[model samples]
Target: MISGSIVALVTPMNADGGVDWAALERLLELHIEAGTGAIGAVGTTGESATLSVPEHCEVIKFCVDSVAGRIPIMAGTGANATREAIELTRAAADAGADCCLLVTPYYNRPTQRGLYAHFRAVADAVDVPQILYNVPGRTAVDMDNEVVAELATHRNIVGIKDATGDRERGRDLIARCGDEIAVYSGDDPTAMDLMLAGGKGNISVTANVAPRQMAQLCALATAGDREGASAINELLTPLNSALFLEANPIPVKWAMAQQGLIGEGIRLPLIVLDEQYHADVRAALEAAGV
Candidate 1:
């Protein structure tokens, strides 16, 4: 089972917004050595929104090569356009990705019917395993549980990364679809609770700095040891909230830089973490024992 702390890894970049290929390899090796369960390359945290299509594919190929079968690799092939998403997913499959984490199309706010059609189109088009990403807060459209259950029946649609952080909804989703698909927590704070309720794993941001802890937590929670998992979860609570101290990769990129895991570069439209949040993020990292 591909169930554990799958880090939504941040792609390393230079301050000038150039893709730092050297730094990228270092980040991949760090996770592989730290025992991270899987890697989600070029997703939101990797600045996927800012990269051109070639750059996006380039990053995915680099991740696939850098990891070299050491760990599972899920490429961020989601796009606002169904055709574009299908094209990217096909390319990722060609690049040897284990699966594709396709987010709900953003900006256009596709309906439940549209969402189903969008994903089904890709599933029919690609033979690789596919994980649906439902982050309504970012995508503007919330895929209802029924929609997810419907999609779960597809041969190639394998699982979902639910980012809503709503436990009740997550539980219902699992009850409806768990037998057919994997239910992964995309929100770090509630991830343990979701796992305790039978979530398969966490596609985590907190794992960026606390991989070993998150991996342990996932193992414990998946194994039904709530007390042990919660102990680690409580310790990681500060980081769960603090990482969003700014928009995603902004704060995470900064945290990674602090530990010298990656350079402090971020793309424009998004910048480095604000000065005010620096000390707070640092304190949170310290609290997580990073």
Candidate 2:
């Protein structure tokens, strides 16, 4: 089962608008040291939409190569086009990623039947494990529990990253799907609660900054130690709210640069975290003792 604090990592960039492979290597080392359970490349947190197709494949390949075999690399290979998703998933598998995370088709906003067909097609195309990503906030489309349960029956459709943050829905999914589908929380704020109520773990944004804490929180929560997990989660509440002060990688990339994890360069169309939100993000970092 895919479990524990899986980090939705940010793609590092250089000043001249190129992928900073060296910085990415360092970030991988950091996560490994911090005990991140798994790593995701080219997800929303990794600024996948903005990256060119070649860049996307390169990032996945780089992550897979850099990590070698330390931890499972779950490549974000989702695309609005089924063909594109299949192409990327095949590349990820060939590049050595252990699994693929496929988000529902955005912009196009397919129906539940379309969603099932898209995922099923990708699973059929690739032999590796596939994890469905359902983040309606960004995609503007939600995959209902029934659809997920149906998809879970596929041999390669192994799990899901539930970003909806609806505990009731998540609980219902767990009760219904049980061992068939491994449900992971994609929303960091409610990750502890979800895990306590039987989620597998979190595919987290918070893990970018507080990897050790996030991993520990997931560990504690997964072990059914609600008290311990809650204590650590409180320390991360500020970070959870702050990193999202801007879109995603904007604040997260800024926070990582503050700690010298990456350079201070974000691609165009997406700028640095606004100056106005600096104090709040910094304060949160301090509060979390990062």
Candidate 3:
């Protein structure tokens, strides 16, 4: 089980909107020192959509190299196009990522059968461990738990990152899959609850700035120490809410920049965090001890 607090890391960029290689290495080192369980590179938070294929592959490669086996890496290799997803997953595996996180095919909104087939195809093609990412809010397509259960049987499909933030859905998925597959919470706000309820871990955006706290919360929750975990989670609630004040990585990138974790560059189609929300986010970060 790829369990614990795994960060959906952001791609640091320069003022000109290019990847900041130095900052990327700095962020990786911070996570390593803070005991982050795993790193999910080129994820939505990492702005995978805007990056070209070569850039995407390079980011994952750079992350794999940067982590230096200090922690596991779950490379984001998903694409709405099945073939592209397969190729990325193959590349990630070749680059020595421990696993691949493949999100549901977006825009086209494929049927449940198509979702299963899509994931299965990638798993079969890559021969690498795969984690199904179902963030319907972003992808416009959700992989039903039934389909997830079916895919859980595939040899290489090991788990699902349920980002729906629905406690019932998380519990149901965990129940249905049993021990065959792991259930990870992709939503930070509800992560502790899901972990206490049988989730194997959290693929967290909040962990980008609050890695140690997130890691500690995951440990408590995974141990079924509900009370202990809840205490830690209370400290993080503000951060969880604030990071999504805008469509993620926007607010997160700004907060990280303020903390000197990364530079202030965010690409187009997605702008920097709005000024109006700055003070509130700053307060949240201060409150969370981030």
Q: Which 10 consecutive residues of model 2 have the lowest summed lDDT?
A: 172-181
| Model 2 clashing residue pairs (backbone) | none
lDDT of each: 0.93, 0.92, 0.93
Model 1, residue 22: distance off in Å is: 1.2
Q: What TM-score number comes out for model 2?
A: 0.98
lDDT of 3 by residue, 104-199 (tens): 999999999999889988988989999999999999998889999999999999999999999999999999995899899999999998999999
Error of 3 at 118 (Å): 0.7
lDDT of 3 at 248: 88
Please count the clashing residue pairs in each candidate, in the order shown.
Answer: 0, 0, 0
For model 3, what is the error of residue 115's alpha carbon versus the real structure, in angstroms, after optimal superposition?
A: 0.7
**Better model by lDDT, 2 or 3?**
3
lDDT score of model 3? Answer: 0.93
| lDDT for each residue of candidate 1 in 48-139, tens digit (9 for 90 to 100) | 99999999999999999989999999899999999999999999999999999999999999889999999999999999999999999898
